[model samples]
Target: MLIVTPVTPVTPTKTNFEFEIMNQNIVKALAGIMEKPGTTKRDTLAISRRVTRYICQQRRHLLTERHALRRKARKLRQYLPFTALAVADLEQQASDHNAELLEAYRRVLAAYGRSIIHDEEGIAAALGFDQLAALLNINPVHHEQAKREGGETLQGLVFVARMEDSASGFADEWGAGGPLFEACMAGLADFIRTCPDHLLPDPFAPGEVFGPKLPPQLRMV
Candidate 1:
């Protein structure tokens, strides 16, 4: 009697590339918030909240889809004798889908980071943040590192912005309404009003550094 052995599919694991992709996505998202259409503090805050909510919604949807695919693949694998090929195919699809989602996320983060670094630097400088930082002895080494490495520094800014916009009264406690804050708001408003074109550059533009490298079917619509 000849016996056939069932082949076990290798479990999908995250690679360094996936981590890099996620990091890029986060930076681009922060840049997006800074580039939103808002001049005054109120307007900028509102726009940032809305955009952040939208990004969260999209991420949740992608996660749900990926989870469902993975679950289905696992179920299919149980019927190994009959479903080996199908299970493997399903696993591959799930992996590809995840990669696509990561790529989409990365594009957003890179775009947002570039917008802040290239488009909004002038606004920050004009608002006297540079001088204020100098006076407060705040080292901008993290900011410089974010510009160079596109890492967690950008994500940290997003967290700060969220906290500032929260209703916990933290902003008030931190003197968020001070002269420097007002100047920052006013400068942002002026930048938005004057250079609307530069705020949200297309991250998926052809030949762009962060453009979509995935196939059309795999890319997020």
Candidate 2:
């Protein structure tokens, strides 16, 4: 009779570490979802939600910065007349910088809006509008009309008049009408979060506490 010795099972420490690494990479990718589009098969609704939330956050941040600059200028205005000239120059510079940042943000939104059109079916499924209509007892004809009206596809049926409009007129609107646009985006994001049958997890969920840092370009400067 031969005695057989039992071997100990391998520890799960390495497996756990690998899982952590994978999670980190996913968080990082989601954070910069707009950086390289068409490279991944991301869910349209998920991307839309994330982008909307990001736009809201960035708009608020930029507004706060602008307010702070204005406050500084106002404070300086109380001093000498020479300081008034300097304050005017400072305000002009701040306005120019804000314009540049707004332009960059508009480009991001335009790209996102086009992507939404590119994946309309995916977005429709993610939004579960059909289910919503059934729950609300809405007419099918009205629902279809709401989504597309007069040869134009509405941005998520309410945000913008048309998908293509996002790149041109919508972009201009966002820059000029920042608060209203931010509110629309916020509402859309909220709808995405509460939409039924949504499979994508929230990018800002608490489980992402140890997520990788955002790239410098993605940061609100």
Candidate 3:
């Protein structure tokens, strides 16, 4: 259906505010999936839908948190040394800010408590990520939770949806990935390889080849 890269957790842009919040909301809701105790499912679509629906308010939350975080981080800088400092002072402020940040995200995460996994197996088959049914571990998931913790929400939703859709279509086209997949892969490779590394603009204009249709400055014998 589509191909795209996932957006970051936090974005520094004006237009993508809502999407940022939705992504944060996702991290909040599927935190369990990221936490030690994780989700149990074989279907990617169901999982994605479940995660997506919970953050109806993601857009708002992202901006609010972003502004709040920037303000707090600024405050932390005043307390920084970029040099050695007393153990107690460093420990106190670091611990304090970390807790504040953690609690803030946790509140948002809790917002997505039961919204994951709606249609179950249907979505998994759709995305073709159904085979990745097992949770390899929690830390990595939590790390993913952290990575997308502050990205543009709308972008992420769009991104994942596109990948699933693209993969699904490709699967159908090549019958679960074959010549069609290779063709697409080859196209991308060619694009990367043949694309000009850099092209400097010409300094001089070309001699006038023609005024409109006839050649310019031509002399008949």
Candidate 4:
């Protein structure tokens, strides 16, 4: 009679390893902009700060969830032989979350870039941001004719009114209250109007070749 030896199976690693790497890279990129003055568009510093704050907040929450998932996956692995399958399921969830977070980060960046261009052009002052408080009450319908024209006429007025309402408290943080400031305002308005409301970019939250592609040219600015 011959003695038989037992076979050892290979253990699988965490399925979300790639997503974790991607998440780290995004963090590093955003942080890099903060550390180096000229890494990103100069006019975007204020908006960048706001975007970073939101991202950091999200990353903190995601980190907690990732840690908790890791612990649970480990515990399950020790107790079950089929742990690989379970871990994969958990990682799938993590992947979905990572995808959403990454998309939001990308959207914010694109929107901000467009805003920088508008600020340089002084579009916000032309919209009469200083008099926004007085114009907020006007029914948006009066501007409907202009809005239909899609010539940026109504969009400008609407942007000023919306910013006055949404980003009411961030005057100083928006920039030196100049074109850069108004650019920040218009950029945020453009993102809000174009992106699905559900994405909820910047909570505070351009033009042709200078803007992102979308209907209502200026609306997507």
Candidate of highest lDDT: 2
Candidate 3, 1-221: lDDT as tens digits: 22222222343476576766666666555544534333444333244344433332443354465555455445545544531233333344444443554454343433222122122233233333223222211132333432232121211222221122332343234323222122223333344455675743232334211112223676899
Q: Assess each prediction's global lDDT (C-alpha) against the native.
A: 0.45, 0.47, 0.35, 0.46
**Worst lDDT 10-window in candidate 3:** 150-159
Which RMSD values do the candidates have, in order? 17.6, 23.6, 21.9, 16.6
Q: Could you tell me which residue pairs clash in candidate 2?
A: none
What clash count goes with each model? 12, 0, 21, 1
How much is the lDDT of residue 27 in candidate 3?
57
User: Candidate 3 — which residues are off by over 4 angstroms?
Assistant: 1-85, 110-221
Candidate numbers, best lDDT first, in rank order: 2, 4, 1, 3
User: In candidate 1, what are the lDDT values of residues 85-166, reduced to their tens digit?
Assistant: 7667767766676577655644443443344334343433443433323332233653443233222221222222212223
Clashing pairs in 4: 206-221
TM-scores of the models, in the given order?
Answer: 0.37, 0.40, 0.20, 0.29
Cα lDDT, model 2, residue 168 = 31
Residue-level lDDT of model 4, residues 1-221, one tens digit each, is 32223322222247656665676677567656656655433323443444544554555566666666566556666645556677666656555555676556555544554644354545435544333323333334434432332234223333332222223433334232322234344456667678897775343223332244355435553
